[model samples]
Target: MTVFVDTSAFLAYLDRSDENHETAVATWTQLLHNRELLVCTNYILIESSALIQNRLGMAAIRDFQELFIPLLRIEWIDESVHQTGVAAWLAANRRRLSLVDVTSFETMRRLFINTAFAFDQHFVEQGFSCLK
Candidate 1:
């Protein structure tokens, strides 16, 4: 089964100080052992990249660029997907949910992916199975 990766999970995995770091690392290790097909949208990538760059500095960003990113299948969000996500976000009118999150939801739905390797509550609220 394909698993969608969220920014929260990426951040936790990269930052040792994060509260979820240990759990994320264990989950990641299990996924690696199982050879799960991980996937994520470009939106998620941008969010994670920016966060890592800001919090962990350029070295972390380089690690993401060279190591982590290549491990997953990227679901590039196109115009239609963007529009759909925008519509969903607007319709939901939830202050907590960002456009990127909605885009990830749309991407997951489009790809028929139901599981997420994430620490984000939004994914669980959206009915996607979250690993942690």
Candidate 2:
């Protein structure tokens, strides 16, 4: 089973101060060891880079890339995905979900994915099972 990894998981993995860091590391270790499938979207990739650079510095980001790059199967986000994200945002009744969340959801749906290594409650509320 492949999982759509979210930016939150990446942040946790990079930030030792985060309460969820261990969970993220443990989950990623399992994925990297061929115990499970791992997937990421362009949105998460870009977000992770920015976050890592800001919080942990470029050196740490490079370390993260070295560790995660070979194990992850990255999927690109496209124009149609943006349209779908906008539609989801506009149709929502009360939830204040962001385009990132919508993009993740759209990509997951398109890829026939049902789970994510996410700490975002929005993902779980929308029916995707989270790692924690």
> In candidate 1, where is summed lDDT lowest over 10 consecutive residues?
62-71
Off by over 4 Å in 2: 93-96
Candidate achieving the largest TM-score: 1
TM-score per model over all chains = 0.97, 0.89
Error of 1 at 119 (Å): 0.7
Give model 2 RMSD, 1 decimal.
Answer: 1.8
Model 1: runs farther than 4 Å from truth?
none
Model 2, residue 82: what's the lDDT? 86
lDDT of 1 by residue, 1-132 (tens): 799999999899899999999999999889888999999999999999989999999998998889788899999999999999999999999998999999999999999999999888999899999997
Clashing pairs in 1: none
